[model samples]
Target: MPERPRIRLVPLAASLAVFALVLRAVHALPDTATGLSAEMTAGAKASGIKNVVTAVLLDFRGYDTLLEIAVLMLATIAVLSLRTDPDALSRRISGVAGPVLGALTRAYVPIMIVVAGHLVWIGSSGPGGAFQGGAVLGAAGILLALSGFARPRWSSGAPMRWVLAVGLLTFIAVALLPLALGGTLLQYPDESRKSLVLLVEILLTLSIGASLTSLFLASASDTSEGERR
Candidate 1:
């Protein structure tokens, strides 16, 4: 007979201890010296972006944004590799509530597109930025996919890939430009800081929006297939 796996309490205890230590370290920080508050105050005047949080995410800590974009790209690629054919699933769904859902999705798609555009455009100056805006756009894509309007196919693959890559590539290129000019990587000491921040934000918004849309569509397709089976 095959042996059953045994639960080891030591590893679990160790994990809990480590987690507690990390939490304690985090809790010990002074309120005024918090990363967010410090970043906000430092970036508020120079970022040109009216929203402090957005400025921090895209400008002050842009390396974090780059890594986030990379993570999103990896996730998108993973999901796409595992995604089911949307057409097959749509055919199955269409037989039942297709028309009703289709109408609703079509009606809302325009509004979603507009909102996403607005979010991306105004992100530098407001609460929304590339990540949030891209999410909104991705949500719109999901709505379309669910409603059976936009079927996933290999033809749309190129644009999707470009969208996924653009943000990260842009960020890398821009970051390197500063380094080439004798500034540190991702540091905009030469050019106006606001200009550099805006450039990064634009790329991030595009990259984030595309990555999210692709991931959502791929996951939705997978879930729909599993349900059918």
Candidate 2:
């Protein structure tokens, strides 16, 4: 008899079956069960945040936010390690972008910064929050990089690193302080919840902005060298 091909399809089939079963189970969950949703809604109101999703992401499930930031940081570091020169692509792109884009970038950077700051400040009671603000700030950085106003070498790596860490460190500090005071981590019953949430949001905004900007520049630099050749 002829030998069968070595490739296995049984495991793949089994995994697909398992995934389908899990999806079905998830779909069967009660849509009307208001337990988790209600709690989040109440937390949003109590924290004075208008956006329920932001409240859930930054305050109700703050530990998850920290982990998410860590994941982004780790992914960035991994990309940097694997790349020859990250900024190469962006730099080359900038070279061909022409003066119009450069002029627009120069004109818009300050406005973007102001808008990002406003979003962070109003996050406790608005649709905008840290992630939104961070994205806007990252856009500004991209503009700066593309316009040739700031190079990766000219930017301060140390200060940027500190900005990236500030949110995680602040969260840790707050959570640990509560634990040190004989309470559970992140249990902020004594202090004003709104205030605490706002502070965290602000730090997260800055940290995420800095981290994203660094990642963009790093990637651009890595890719730029290749394009130049």
Best by lDDT: 2
Each model's lDDT comes to 0.71, 0.75
- Give a tens-digit lDDT track for model 2, residues 82-193: 7665446545655444679767886899999999999988776667898999999888877777676776543335676677788878877776767877878777654476
**Per-residue lDDT of model 1, residues 65-99, tens digit only:** 77877787888777777755645445544533366
lDDT of 2: 0.75
**lDDT of residue 208 for candidate 1:** 76
Candidate 2 residues lying further than 4 Å off, grouped into runs, are 1-19, 86-98, 154-156, 221-229
lDDT of 1: 0.71
- The superposed Cα distance between candidate 1 and the true structure at residue 75, in angstroms, equals 1.9
